[model samples]
Target: MTFDSLGNLYGTTYEGGGEKSEGGGTVYKLSPGSSGWTETVVDHFLPTGQYGVAPLGEVSFDPHGNLYSTTSLGALGVGTVLEISVNGQSRIFSFDRVDGAVPAAGVLVDARTKTLYGTTTGNIYNHGNVFRIAASGQETVLYDFCQQPNCTDGSAPFSGLISDEAGNLYGTTEFGGANGLGVVFEVTP
Candidate 1:
């Protein structure tokens, strides 16, 4: 889910609508209706192998009002980052997995830098990784898990991240940490 600059709410669903898995997901906008709340599915995920399936996680918006999110299992068996235009045009960020795989978190786009940050569940290691997807679609790994004892730093970020004004990222771990009770971490760019 996400909030726009004017505080409008938007979101995407992974599954469970009338169109079934073939429909993939729905991009929605939320607003206050006369009765209470109203939601509209701005776009429906097409049943195509090229487009990723089951979009998941919180959403983010670009300055132009495009929304972004990720999918886990997709037509390629990897994953994808997608942009939904305010007018409802869908565009794939389009990065192949030489860099990583199976993205499970919403993208954090640093609009000032035109760079995007995300995490992926990789093929070789289920441990997952944080990666950078450039505006030009070049992908790079920022961190990988060793999967040893304490995980030393932290492991498996299952949610979206928050960045400070200084360009530092703060997030949580779902598993594998010092006390095995999960962890909170700061990543400096």
Candidate 2:
């Protein structure tokens, strides 16, 4: 699902309303109603692996009203990020390891530069990396962890990051810090 400009919500449920996981998914819309709020299931998964498995990530809308998101499992266990248009048209983006395999979090789009950034659960150099996936789908490693003694700079950033108005990126570590209880830090471009 995706978010409209006014903050109304839309999303999907992979299973449970009927035949379990094989029945595909359900597209839903959540919006403020006069008395309260309402939910509508707009579509359902088709039981074909090509359409995807559970929808496990956040959804974002492009300026042209196309919705985009990824599922943790689908299309051969490697996962996929797909685009769903307002006319109900959907297609996979042909994502693979070069885009930082297994993205476990949502993508952050840099508004000014139109760059897409996300982190992965996969590891390189014994730890995960912060990655930037450009509009052209070329991904670059911005930082790799466990490079320092005691990893004072932080390690294993499990969640993704956000950049402030000044263009500083902020994120957290699941391990390795002053006291090892986890820490939140920022990076400057």
Best by lDDT: 1
Task: Return the TM-score for each candidate structure.
Answer: 0.85, 0.71
Summarize candidate 2's per-residue lDDT along 1-189 as a digit string, tens digits.
457887678876646334644565555778887887688665555646574556655666666656666555566554555666756746444344443445555566675555666565445344555676566655677766556778776776667678888877788777777887556767665
Candidate 2 error regions (>4 Å): 1-3, 11-18, 23-27, 41-48, 87-99, 124-126
Q: What tens-digit string does per-residue lDDT give for candidate 1 at 41-158? A: 7766665746676777778877777777787756566778877775654555544565567777788989887688877655356666777777776777777654567675566677
The Cα error of candidate 1 at residue 153, in Å, is 2.7
Q: Residue 55 deviation, candidate 2, in Å?
A: 3.4
Cα-based lDDT at residue 53, candidate 2 = 56
